[model samples]
Target: FSPIQRVNYKIEETRVGRLTNYDKLILEVWTDGTMTPKEATVSAAKTLVSYFNQIVSPKKVEKKEVKEEADVIGPMGKLSVEEIGLPTRVANALVKAGYETVEELAKAKKEDLVKVRNLGEKSIKIITVALVEKGVKFGE
Candidate 1:
């Protein structure tokens, strides 16, 4: 979500309480009940900004947690795909196909690895070079 200069309306309120951008300033607006849309938004924004400046609390940011699925990745999150040094498309396909680590890819049989949709002989050769660079050889 993009940050606004000022925020005044409730973005969403669920059972977990009001969910909003951590950086936004949420405030209640009380107009004469006959204000136009533009006037209301402008006035409410001003009040929100004013209140935010007067607040003493520090802003909080939410951090996202990355979780690897066990059954899917199958004991293979040790090495990053970037370390494989394969061409972009092939390396990305390998990662997407659940080979998370170079060691895991090295353990696979050539015949089996050839079955992957986007990977081909040229990509396989590239992968071999990458694995050899890391002191690993496929089908060892």
Candidate 2:
């Protein structure tokens, strides 16, 4: 994301400026002709997108060795929530809701966790991120 690509303009002199993407070819925006900020932004963005789309560029993809799923340990069903280093409150809530292990937590849905006491959106996000790092996902 370039600072030049996105920006908010204020009151300035009505003039023309050139923006270049690649090949050193200049794209001149006739902002003086544009009435509003919306018009200028839309005109500039459309010009860039259309110009780039028209350019033909071929990209090559390289095949890499695929890792077998069997190599990953997968979910830890026998491990407790505390063992996974979850927050005390979140772990307590999961335990109270009958989700003791990582496997149980992975099986739970977003709706089910919302019903659990003391667990909110933030807690769910943390739990989901941790589980994802362990190759465990909830709600299939």
lDDT of each: 0.66, 0.71
Q: What is the lDDT of residue 85 in candidate 1?
A: 68
Candidate 1 lDDT over 1-140, as tens digits, reads 31223435554433434744345345555455466445776865799988887686646768866653433334333577676467789878888887877657866888877898898888888887776666565654
Query: What TM-score do all the candidates reach, one by one?
Result: 0.43, 0.46
| Candidate 2: pairs in clash | none
Q: What is the lDDT of residue 103 in candidate 2?
A: 70
User: Which numbered prediction scores highest in TM-score against the true structure?
Assistant: 2
RMSD per prediction, one decimal? 17.1, 15.5
Off by over 4 Å in 2: 1-75
Q: Considering every candidate listed, which one attains the maximal lDDT?
A: 2
For model 2, how does the per-residue alpha-carbon lDDT over 1-140 read when each residue is reduced to its tens digit?
Answer: 22233344344334345743324333333334325545766766899888787675535568877754323336476678888878999999999999988777776789999999999999998898887777665655
